[model samples]
Target: MGKLGGEMKALAKHCGGSHKTVNDCIHIVQRFDHHLLALNVHIQRVAQIKVRHIESYIHERLAQGIGKRTLQNEMASLRAVLQQAGRKQVAEHEWLTNKSLGLAGASRSGTRQAITPEHYHHVLETARMKDPGLAAALELARLMGLRSQEAVQSVQWIWGMGTGVGGMWRRCMGKFDSWLRASSGWSRLPPFTVSERLGGGGKYQAALPSPLQSKPESDRTNVEINERTCPE
Candidate 1:
């Protein structure tokens, strides 16, 4: 059978209540079927995927004018699917060795300009006038140095006495910055979930512990609360 047929069988066997995981896995795997079929490469039996095969897939995408980032994700997804099937050394394939596909580091360039204080307020004002949730996301992105992708999906507000919380963030969907900056202590924020944040799903630990501020404790005595502040 062709690769699509094989994937179809996989999807069929994987569907239904007990097979939710299999269905999800198939969904992720099927995204590549269109491209694979176009190249006449069969995806049946992951063992057939020589490293050179993956290289050709990448080269084909580049030749057809696909962006490096999209191609990178495509390869990553394929690698994951194969690995999930218990195939080891997925990346060990010699053709797949050019890990980054000669592309520049994602964060090295093209990230949007960080919002300066002035621009930050402007964007906030605009977002408030148009959409408060979106404005709040802008604020979080600015204060937290989070990518826009990480900002919008934050729904609840987690406050602390001193240094703020930290975690992987993206897919910013709404605006809400509503905590008072009153005391000084690293705070443990609550956790929430959403669609994969490009790069998310770590252990959800306080992995990067917040550093306590250097300001004198005596001077930071008063507690000031503001209801007007948005939650981000």
Candidate 2:
């Protein structure tokens, strides 16, 4: 391995970086070598790396039909190597931003279309017919807006339910120890209303569900569950 490669491996080890990321960085560094030579610039001095070199590289890659995401990765590689070589200021230059690279909010492939109410119901009915278990998971997402992961993973029936001052309340956990509540109405419904448990250690209160389908809170009191994560 060259000095650049060795330094990169060391940086990855030091920072617990991913092997794939380190490999990508190394590839970018190699490309930069050829690019520097073509531009009649020295590759030896890390301190001599300028914004113009980076900008030129970006344009050259883009001209070759390289994608915004790929360019972004290459830029990240440049920053990593420069930062490791004590050229932190160069890496942090204002000209090196994602926006400057014309990659800010770049349209990505395979974007999902927004789900309509009719489509949602159709999916739910189909899912129910095929797999009740999957249908339950989907229903949790649809009614409560819990993330698919949160609905499937974080839910625990083992914790059991508790009777509160107002009604029966069961505390549920969401992503990152975010507690959700399952109350009386939740149990009565097909899928229990997923409530987010708020506050600190051992103290959690069931948050009131959001108004559903543009209906008033009072109107949907029977099924007062907040919509959280969007179901795919």
Candidate 3:
């Protein structure tokens, strides 16, 4: 870790929360510190943080097109850090509030659209042309409803299965094959059911039904073969 990271980590130790929450607070504060550094404001400690600094940070982020929801979360994290530093007045200052910063209420409305088959195929082909390994990883992420890091880690887990690692690969693939046989179509399949017991630290467990599952056995075999043969 760099100087800013170390400082943020020390400040985060004063915070009270779960491990993830503390780490998240540290990350946000580190970002703020980096931003201050960029602006030629050398704030080496949290005690140096002022309402003006936060207001300036907010305005800079807003100008950079940061979303209201994200800004709200950032402000909350900063507030926690500031409060821990015994700067309650500065933390609760009106100028630092979301409303005062012109940050609207965060919305929970779902706006994501599922990837269409045509688009998926097009991107897959393009990725294949660039790198077969990347194409395979992309397929794994899509079929398993995994984030990029999860897909990579899952592949590693699969390779390490017989070495007393775990059975996540076998279980996920078995569930995927079963879902393939039972589902009518893959154009609008339900979201994958995440198993919290099996998935620690927000990693997904079960594989979801995907359009590739609707393909012929030969095509499915090709994907599996690609996954196995692709260079790590």
The candidate that wins on TM-score is 3
Displacement of residue 34 (Cα, Å) in model 1 is: 2.3
Tens digits of per-residue lDDT for model 2 on 82-151? 7777888888888889898787786667666779989988997999799866776776666565557545
For all candidates in order, the CA lDDT equals 0.48, 0.58, 0.64
Our tally of clashes for model 3 stands at 0
RMSD of each: 13.6, 12.6, 11.5
Q: Write the per-residue lDDT of candidate 1 for residues 1-232, one digit (tens) a residue.
A: 4665465446444333323345444554564455566777756766655666666667767888877776665565566656655555865464574444654454435767644678767767888899866876665555444445545533322322223332112111122122222122111222223423334744122222222245565644333223323233
What are the runs in model 3 whose C-alpha is more than 4 Å off? 1-5, 10-27, 83-89, 105-108, 161-232
Top candidate (lDDT):
3
Question: Sort by lDDT, best first: what order?
Answer: 3, 2, 1
Select the stronger candidate by TM-score from 1 and 2. Answer: 1
Better of 2 and 3 by lDDT: 3
Candidate number that wins on TM-score, 1 or 3: 3
Error of 3 at 35 (Å): 2.5
